[model samples]
Target: MSRDIHKKPFDEGTKAKLAIFRDYLREWLPVFIAKREIYWNTINIYDFFSGPGSDGFGNKGTPLIILEELNPHFDNIISKKLNVNLYLNEYDQSKYEALKKNVSPEKGDVRPYSIQIENLDFKISFKSKFPEMGNKGNANLLFLDQTGVKHINEEIFSKIINLKQTDFLFFISSSTIKRFAEHPSISRYIKLNSEDIEKTPYHKIHRLVLEYYKSLIPQNKEYYLASFSLKKNAGLYGLIFGSGHVLGIEKFLTTCWGIDKERGEANFDIDEDKIQKGQFDLFTNEVPKPKKVDLFEKELKEGILNKSLPSDKAIYLFTITNGFLPSHARKIIAQLIKENKIQKSSFNLSTKVCKSGALVTQVKPL
Candidate 1:
């Protein structure tokens, strides 16, 4: 990819989201590769709406960022001779050419990476190649980083979710959906019913869409989801992450909360906080207090009232369900133990090495 193409300039919010994407892959790929080492020989990555290598201002786009993120592990991967497949798609001809040039290894670049660039419409291309993309014994990560919600319909989402060992990250413009809620075209894309469109509050549309998407997934298949709303002030977009494992949701939420700890938009009750912390003056001396934690504790108590889970499973449940971190779960459980409200098999279990199933039961108030 020539760095000279006039590319689109990413705003501060877009940059933050891109950084989150990179960080997620950085945390996930290594762990995923290790876990799949026993069963798979290849790791396949797909970016359906990959843009040119750089923006008009010459800033690296998602494709280049993905390449950069993967380059560091070449030495380790090459030693094992593990096949790493990269499939990037760009509908624009100029961007397609640039993406090919950018991902092609330059001189002295010793990375043994298999890269394929497609210049066709992503929806059509993905549909035609869906079966080949999801080969058994190979793990896949699809990045449907489209410009908007035009192509991400139910068909694409269901196919990806149903595919064996495949996970996905995509962007959704909740603000746009809310703004155009009444429009028939927008309602069709978001799958909003007439009743929902008429009766549902605008603020609740995003949550409804999320729940609807989750409901579409088959019940037998387990998926852990995490989402982050970006630039609430600007009302741009939010990211939705769906993974086949609990660890994936944990890592994604960890990154999202780490980035926006003050509000915890991805996992916490940010709407209430935003309403309460509405429009503070810069000159004002008052500082908004942190949001309360009692809600999370209550959630934990209910989930663990009378449960026997591998300690890891308990942590995963609370984390994904209530956006509590493992540390927070441990703290809440410790408090319950202290109050004699709950009983645990042992107190020595740590989050990372908690392999044994821990039996926990709530004590009845006599």
Candidate 2:
């Protein structure tokens, strides 16, 4: 059985993971709240594996974090006349009782939004609440902080994929998959071959697991997925965030890149970029970009010069699909124009650029 984390203070890895969760929710809430009536009439937030509200040291867990983050938005939510619901579920009985006590209104937990705490199994709770999530006028955010890798199987994942106007973040122990690649229990949920696991490097095990999940996405779907790996001693764990909208992707990427500027994907240097941090080229005496940045810029330059990326919209899609922020693409565009390799054109590389009827300018390659 997995160890009880609430029995002890949160370690560094757990703290980092919760920080990202908090940051992303901080970015997510306002978007749907501000869109009230215009796009969505309701906002639903679900935390499937919310713990006993905190660890042994009383640090806030996901459930408490959600409430705390939403506190400031109460006035806005009330003014906009939007309906916001929070569904927090914990499977363990002891934790469920503790969760109730922690967030009880008697303890000054009064708030503007509606909240429901459940002690049912995750699959059951998910099934009961999915209809509300699938409603066209509701915007949803789902958090599944499962103890192990078994909860989010292919069936549940497919259901999540089909939901519109929904964003999700789930935690997984990628190191477990790497350590037990050939084990029957692990293979029951993940179909990755042991040989492929052996080929991947230790730090990138999470990325490999993410690729397996990405393979499940249907060929025709336009979904955005990103990951942030957290390393605790020798063990590797991570969060996989998914959204079907460009704005959702932009907000998530913004939160991630804010935490990790080097790779924008991890707590530690997942790409081992320390060696190149301040290295200057002997010939030009200029600092070299990190490997990931250098590779992305090179690809963007080639695409523009070859006319493959011919417009602002195409470049915006390419930038997001390649796991980059528009600012990164903007830098390359500026450089290309200065070099006279591409003619200057008005560029509106943003989430709005992909909206229906948004103007897109052509990139004239000289």
Candidate 3:
């Protein structure tokens, strides 16, 4: 049998990162559901590349992070005998053996979840398990993480993705293929993500891969991409994610987008806005046409001048409520300042970081 090429069990640093994010997700989820009661079997998590429960190599894997995250929520999860249902897929025999030991209780049925594990390689049976993932108003959050992309075909992912309520967070290692892209033969794997096979170039497989993944989802929904690196050669890998609802997007951002204490120096950590469709087109070279943002600011300027807002403080209020970029909003303020529609000596003179978090100074003069 062909062996699955992969990243070995995680180390302590990796585990710690996982724990932080797991906790982050859990924190947002409750805040996400604050308006609604969680019905039975309404939530689920799918750890597709789940390593064994522990690394013994001095790290806890996803299983450990997941269990730890779930443990606190156990009471709410337990409906009669069932805690929450966890589906764990680990291909390695050694890892599975380790997981079996860690996941079981020392005594009775003290565990709060219903779990199913497949000890075979994830590639061998990942597609086959789709139907079993099931669905609800909530969903199965599948973590299709891997050391690199392999054995993934569009058809296979479509099956997993077609689950009405299912969303995916994929670990896509982009570094490996930059060099490999020179050879057309090595590009077939990239084509697996193709949107339209007929239109795709046999050479530009990476484009196809992205298109295919996008094709698998319902459009007009938000998705996200975040990158992490072990070293320079470690390359950029995208953690691409999708969700079907706005509330999920709101929950995801509130937790994952750690507050930028300094602000606007780095791109607003819009990474947390998961349901946000397409990324904020960051300016490179020449500032790419401000598109939607420039226009939005125009409206904001009009609103500010005519006293549509009580104060420039109200402008910040608009930003907080509307989630507009500080840069974009600042453009609106800059225009208002130039037009002389709104003057200095209006609001507090000092705290002039405009409502959008971008710098625009229309401070009232002393």
State which candidate has the highest TM-score. 2
Candidate 2, residues 1-366, lDDT tens digits: the string is 356788989989999999999999999988888555458878999999999999959799999999899988988888888889999999999999999988777656568889899999998999999888988788899999998798899999989988999999999999999888888889999889789999999899999988999999999999988888999656899999999998888888888899888768889888776746668888979885668888998999999999999999999989887778999999999999999999988899999999999999999998
Candidate 2: regions farther than 4 A off: 106-109, 276-283
**How much does candidate 2 score in TM-score?**
0.96
RMSD to the true structure for each prediction, in A, is 5.3, 1.6, 10.5
lDDT of 3 by residue, 96-185 (tens): 777888777667657666777778777665756665666444456777657666545556565655566555556555444544554454
Per-candidate TM-score against the hidden true structure: 0.82, 0.96, 0.59
lDDT tens digits by residue: candidate 1, 1-366: 012223447766677778888988998778755454446667888888888876758677788888888877776577767788888899999888877887788798666778888899987779866887677778788888776566778878878777776778898767677667777767776776657645655544556567667877788877766677665334646788888766677777778767876544543354566534455546865655445355666656775665444344554565565555676677866777777866544533233442345543333321
How should the candidates be ordered by TM-score, best one leading? 2, 1, 3
Model 1 TM-score relative to the real fold: 0.82
Q: Regarding TM-score, does 1 or 2 come out ahead?
A: 2
Residue 18, candidate 3: Cα error in Å is 1.9
All models: lDDT? 0.69, 0.89, 0.51
Q: Alpha carbon lDDT of residue 333, candidate 1?
A: 67
Residue 98 CA error for candidate 1 (Å)? Answer: 2.4
User: How do these models rank on lDDT, best leading?
Assistant: 2, 1, 3
